[model samples]
Target: MRKLVYLVATTIDGFVSDAADSDPTGTVFDPVGAHAAPLMAEYPEMIPTHIRPMLGLTDTPPKHFDTVLEGRGSYEIGLAGGVTNAYRHLRHLVFSTTMTGVDDPAIELVNTDPAARIRELKAEDGLDIWLCGGGTLAGVLRDEIDELHLKVYPVVLGKGVPLFGIPTQDSRPGLDHFTLRSATPYDSGVSLMIYDRTR
Candidate 1:
């Protein structure tokens, strides 16, 4: 009865990374910050609009997950940016075969089959599991994912890492439920789409 939430940002074309497995041009825009300088002067809700409901911040997540899971690349990105520690919200579990050790004591490193461990995690008690992804991780765990919070942007990456990498015939995952939520316009003409996955 544990829930796995895949929360990510994808281009309008559904590519999570460029062809080289890197973020496309506008995946993370500064709308909430840039626009805030001028817009917030007129409307306070304009800033919160980009967050809160748009990012599923309203409901408190189920108290079944005390850890957050992210691919190695995502964790590296944070590390390179000087975040040597996990965020205040949750314990971090980073999956990386290449990473020998994690500098952050708060983060535990897992180098084996992530999908298998994720399934095993469901049996434990904590807050809901968050699948902070990169294309490689998503493709691998597509079957175990229970919910997908897709933040669709209005722009297109043209050619970047696809949201779902091509899987082998035996591993393709199918969606059982999908719901579209409110969309907010950001810089680069992208709108965020929140999708709840139930399979």
Candidate 2:
């Protein structure tokens, strides 16, 4: 089966946005763009000195997998203004119930059973699926997620959007199997931690 990998960044307080939902709470972290470096340089006090080298401060456009999957809201965040193949380098799949279809050739929108469809993708020959954004889709398919690659920024957003909307009741999300995978400290006191789920 194909695997679903969630790669996202969140605040230390566990919120993705602010009360207004206008943008991320801190200036030190940028989840969607090439925002990490500049933010770090501006606020050296926020980031730990020891962690900088480990985090690959110079790295931008990092790739954890070859496939990208996202919910409509998540997709819109990067595409609302216009067309730009955010994940053009790889296969992109968008999950949306409101969208009748997608005109963007770069993305394939699914109005069908997303979880089941993901299962089919997992069965394919190779590559893991990158679950890109929004809590709703993640909540809906909580069972399908196999790993979470979170870039934990140090700031705290008392409230805003959460990373996962679903509450796992029947079983744990399986954090024990996670390999520290990778990590690096940012200049903003934030550390990017990538966790790989083991099945």
Candidate 3:
């Protein structure tokens, strides 16, 4: 089975966005511009095809996942600007309770148990599935996650949406066991940490 990887960026305070409750779509983490150099260089596949050349990474191929998953709020960040498909290179799947359909043909809208669908995706033959964003969805599918690919930045968001929407560690005590597989630190104080679920 393919791995369900929660590949996301987070601040030192463990918040994914700045004031997620108030402005979830706002770009809270400011260091992404400077941090993008090492990140895009190391993980070229993560670069979207639309702005690849603009970032001087046109030939970069997706190195990790062949499919990407996102929550409604995560996908809506681009939807407000008429961009339904942000990552056009990979297979995009968005989870939403209210969104029945979307304008983008490349993106699929699903309103059901995300964990069940994730399990089914793992059974298929392809690269691992990338849990793109949203702490709420991450909290819901916490158990189903096999690995975490975190881009840890130096900034701190005192109050915002957490890495996981809810407290996974507090809710399931002694269940959230993970070991750091590797940690690559960059000059910009951004670290690429890969942790595997070891339970």
Candidate 4:
């Protein structure tokens, strides 16, 4: 069975994007820093297909994930840039109920329950699934996530999207479902932290 890995970049304050929810790359966060080399070398699959040639990773095989998942917002970010399918090299699934007319055969739109679909995907034989997210989708599939590979930057976005998209003041108490597996600090003040689900 393959694992569902929520691989994302976040700020020290635990925000994935700023208040406007814009693309963090090269704007709020620098992707070409010291951490770039190691990250690209290890998880080349995370790089969008269109960006591989410039980064000299055209032939580099994916090390961690074979499939990629995203929410409507995350998918639209690329669509807005005229990129219908960003991760063309991977099996891409976009969860959206209101989105329609996506003619890209390479991308599949999932309108059903996220957790149920993830459970079905986990039972298939393949590399781990990469949950390239927006917070709302993360909240829906929180319990189904098997691992979290976070690129923690040093910046602090005073307010923005939460890591899980769950309200901080929600009545439900937090659960310790994951344990820190490794933490790799880079000279650029960025850290690659990996956590594995223990429950």
* Candidate 3: stretches off by over 4 Å: 21-27, 31-34, 167-174
Kindly provide the TM-score of model 4 when superposed on the true structure, using C-alpha atoms. 0.95
Residues 60-85, candidate 1: write the lDDT tens digits. 33343456787887666656656665
| Candidate 2 local lDDT, residue 92 | 77
> Candidate 4 residues 8-119, lDDT tens each?
9999999888777777788777988899999888899999999999998888888989999999888888978999899989999999888874758988889988888999
TM-score of 2: 0.70
Off by over 4 Å in 4: 166-173
List the candidate 2 regions with Cα displacement exceeding 4 Å: 19-28, 31-63, 166-183
Flag clash pairs in model 4.
none
Root mean square deviation (Cα) for candidate 1: 6.8
Cα-based lDDT for every prediction: 0.62, 0.64, 0.80, 0.88
Highest TM-score against the true fold, candidate: 4
Lowest lDDT sum, 10 consecutive residues, model 3, at 22-31
**What lDDT score goes with residue 125 in model 2?**
66
Lowest lDDT 10-residue stretch of candidate 4: 165-174
Tell me the lDDT of model 4 at 61: 84
Error of 2 at 42 (Å): 23
TM-score of each: 0.69, 0.70, 0.88, 0.95
